[model samples]
Target: MSPPVTAPAGRKKTLSHPKKANNMPRQPRTFKAFIVLCAIALSSPFTTPATQNAQAQQNRAVQNQMQNDPDTGSKKGWWSGLPREKKMLYTTTASAAAIAVWGLATWDYGSSSGFHTAHEGAFEENAKYGGADKMGHYFATYAISDMLTGLYKSYGYDTRKANNYGVLSAWAVQAFMEIGDATSESQGFSWEDTMMNTLGALTSILMARYPALDDKIDLRVEYIANVRIGGIFDDYSNQFYSIVLKLDGFDFIKNNFLKYLELSAGYYTRGYDTDEVKKRRSVFAGVSFNLSRFFYQKHYNKTGKVLEYLQLPYTVLKGSRDLD
Candidate 1:
């Protein structure tokens, strides 16, 4: 072989490095206006007279219960005297503030020259992370609603009020985040994300109104270890979005061995972080032991609660079909 090549006498040689995969920019904040819209939406869940009349009767029953319940009258904490709406406002505001700070510090919020919009294809096989980000939006709002429902109930709000406030709070918080994204240099407001957020919040309300449904189905995220990208929430390559149906939810199955099993359907993407040319989107069906139910049976309630939203790896035996 010939001698190794070299730069000309007067020129300097430059070294080239492999390019890094671009992480999707972090995602929001017209809160006051959005709150008005949320209120209008919440005020009318049904349009027909018969359904409206039924809802009115239900509301009156809830009010009667609250008026008669001794626990509702008890003063247990410093904020007990505050109105439930004010409590919800304060809590929502605090959550928004925390998210704003996080966005500013890590997501470069307000660094853009002006507000903008981005068209992130929703659940399209070719979209970024094969639409894992959309699932992220859905999961975030759904989880937030569930947590806020518990909070509102603890604050003495009745079931309907608590469910309504939870959805409202979750929607408002997500809308604020999207508004912030509009101002970020590396991110833009995404209508698809907003739509997913709404779906998530609505699902939460549906589950709250029907405990049996909640017990039967779960929307969850599963994370497997991989190279870090931005943060855990931003690590799409390692994450899977799953919709699980638990046999334990059925009365007959609950008394049999099948109760310890669960079926899951999910979507995930691969090679987005390091190999765009070979990126793949896949849909999967899986069977997994009901670890959440196991935790509940062991009386590890807190662990069970966490498992409800997060699927532990190595627990699922899955088969996947590539979308592209």
Candidate 2:
């Protein structure tokens, strides 16, 4: 065999052994690993020390709720009556922490604070200039609303609303930030941000109202009869089209508006990603407790329902009844 033909220097010599098949597929390239690492790095600074502390409190609440309703899956109360001072401290601290995260995320590490990011108006402007068809628009809206909802829920606000409080809150928070940004030296009011915020808030409200719809569905599944989540992704679709008409000046999806609605029905339901979800739930519980304390003390301090609410978890756990 002429002393076993030598292989090329750079390439592997696996072919030298005939028994080892070269047909085995090459190892798959994985950007997933890079994406995960980047995500961690990006999200890390956003979790402030104060936020972490609040998240701990929220975790305790969730654990208590779970113990109280191992099968019921109903949330238990924890902050029926904290003092006014405590409540204010809680809210101020949590809000400041969230704001810090937002500031840092938007901050430029290089200069103190400039009028533009390196890419300047290109990415944000194009996202706006391109109109409502872009995924960045959707992501922006979803991220803001989702983050707000998570924060509010963490603070202990019962957001299950028939009216528009949730949207109001979402819009209020985002619009305020936008106003601040517009007044700033670097970034001015991009119609894109406004349109995106409006769509996101409206989407959240609409979805909250009609929890079961199919066509615009992102994740369509039911955890139980009447109890479901992620059915009305169309609400966001509606907001998109509306913005298209208002800002982008388009109406292509207009005709199919009615047909676009969709409803989902199922037995099993998948939840959010494990780590983030858990952290979110903790944040939700902490905020909930803090807010509850403020509200209860303001309204029912004399009645002493605060203690009642705190013990409510224990009662629910002991009762082991189905969620109402």
Candidate 3:
């Protein structure tokens, strides 16, 4: 299972500064580097025909073993032989408790006089971090649900049961976090965030119920490595939240060169962390190599799984339209 990318649940104020004058000139050079790197990745030994064929054979053998081996059933009870629902209940309770403790310590929860609400605008030009934070909320819940689905499946739950529990667990956990925010001195519950979280959990349920849809689309976050002082999860200026459409998901494209390509559209904000006077919100569309599929083809299954939720930086060439 892929790890969930946690989103920050609190907001912090920053001092405003002037925008950089020479920032525009660096983009072309950066894109040129990206193109070169992508070219190398495509032609690398990992994608060679021989390597792919060998990997396919290895994967098939592994799948056959899992299906036929009686030992697999015995191994299912390796974790204390607990019932499925009991495992789920314990896991969810523990996770929520852990998050609550962390929030109370770091986010100033319970420091406020009373419960409160915040009216953070959604996707508006002037909204906090130009609404990048909203997308973070969405992606966090979506990823959490997906991760929980895998966990529940391992706990011996059927597919439908696992997915439902995953969705509900994710929603509950996020709602818990938001409620904690309502009691915080530095933050308050925002309906907009809750709405996005609900949508994300719903999307996860839909995708889990439909394998073809899951294969076709992904919600991924691309993080640019920078000398930023904070954790990557909360670095809105260095993150792009993207919806990727894999061309290989279609039968017509699966056998062709186009299978290695994907289409992406995403949003990101610039100068938000530094609180520049000219904060920019941009929406972008681009073509990216389907590296996750490539890794799967090469039998790097774990890496492929991670890439499904995390977009590798410098793997795309985007043309962005500034919204602000």
Candidate 4:
């Protein structure tokens, strides 16, 4: 046995943060934008004529219109539904949601006063820069739209029309926030944020319109638990260090067994709130499970449905690594 065969110590290879090497000038939310662009490219050709498609799917039984039908496909009056008390309850609940979003937009945030920064081309600097914040925007927009769709569906709206109203409600809140940020003395509305939000909302819409494709993929996010709440709004480190998954892309067996498994690659940023730690942008890869997949009978329904709004756990503990 060659005992103690210790070689002379040479220069040790130090592990460094990845952001230093690939520090390209990214426009706020650049990675999400790239992801959205790729989704769009793979979705379908952009040449479909909207008017023609609309006419092709026009209501076939418009001649036998019912009195209880909604006035328009996308909106309804406060008193349009049955049971006045239920309608009022729905109205109140919906209004509360809107008000909550308003409060968030108007929050002072207590940061350096660079408010109302809607100057031309100013978004280049303020647009979250594809950091953890972009993941929040994406997750929220997708989640909210799905919730609204369910709310509208409960009120007896058609699937297409309900989805439209849901998208509208989600975008309305997002738009309000963006406008507020634009006018903020401390912050400017960021095109980067806008891009991610739009992509998220559009994802819900696309999923709603295409049930087949929605069955094949699942979009989900997870947060690492940390002590700092970082106020009621933004948590750049723990909350923002989101694990986003575009799951179940590889079902090699074509059976439902592999249908719930997924692959994930995500961005992580260190020390955004501090000046002390060297801000090293890192990337990670991992595998996660759609818990619902194990109990297929329960979640057999596809996306764009109300029940899909529940943030199901990526239950399985699996492997992950920071990319070099």
Please list all clashing residue pairs in model 3, or write none if there are none: none
lDDT against the true structure, each candidate: 0.64, 0.29, 0.67, 0.43
**Over 4 Å off, model 4:** 1-106, 109-115, 118-130, 227-234, 239-256, 274-276, 295-324
Per-candidate TM equals 0.74, 0.32, 0.77, 0.56
lDDT for model 4 comes to 0.43
Error of 3 at 16 (Å): 16
Of the candidates shown, which would achieve the greatest lDDT relative to the real structure?
A: 3
Q: What does candidate 3's lDDT look like per residue over 34-137, in tens digits?
A: 22223322322222233446755775786597689967656754554576788899878877897688767666668668886677687778675677777877
- RMSD per model, one decimal: 14.3, 23.5, 9.3, 15.4
TM-score of 2: 0.32
Task: Provide the lowest-lDDT 10-residue window in model 4.
Answer: 1-10
Residue 298 local lDDT, model 2: 62
Residues 1-324 of candidate 2: C-alpha lDDT, one tens digit per residue: 000000000001111221123242111001111122223223322222234467678768876976787863433334534543454346434534553354345421122233321111212222211222222233334333433333344444434531243345445544444443443233333454556557655665554455342012231101121213223221111111111101111234454332322222111111211112321110000001122223333654212211211111211111111111
Q: Which stretches in model 2 have alpha-carbon errors above 4 Å? A: 1-138, 143-159, 162-165, 214-216, 219-324
lDDT of 1 at 175: 85
Clashes of 3: 0
The TM-score of candidate 4 is: 0.56
Question: Higher TM-score: candidate 2 or 3?
Answer: 3
- Per-residue lDDT tens digits of candidate 1, residues 1-324? 000000000000011212112443332111122223223323322112223356558757866977888676464566866787888899889868976886688556777678866676776665654676677677767766766665676565766787788778878988887787777655667788788889978888888778788789987777676755554434467777799999988887646679988999999877754445788889999999898788767865445655776688668899999988
What is the TM-score (0 to 1) of candidate 1? 0.74
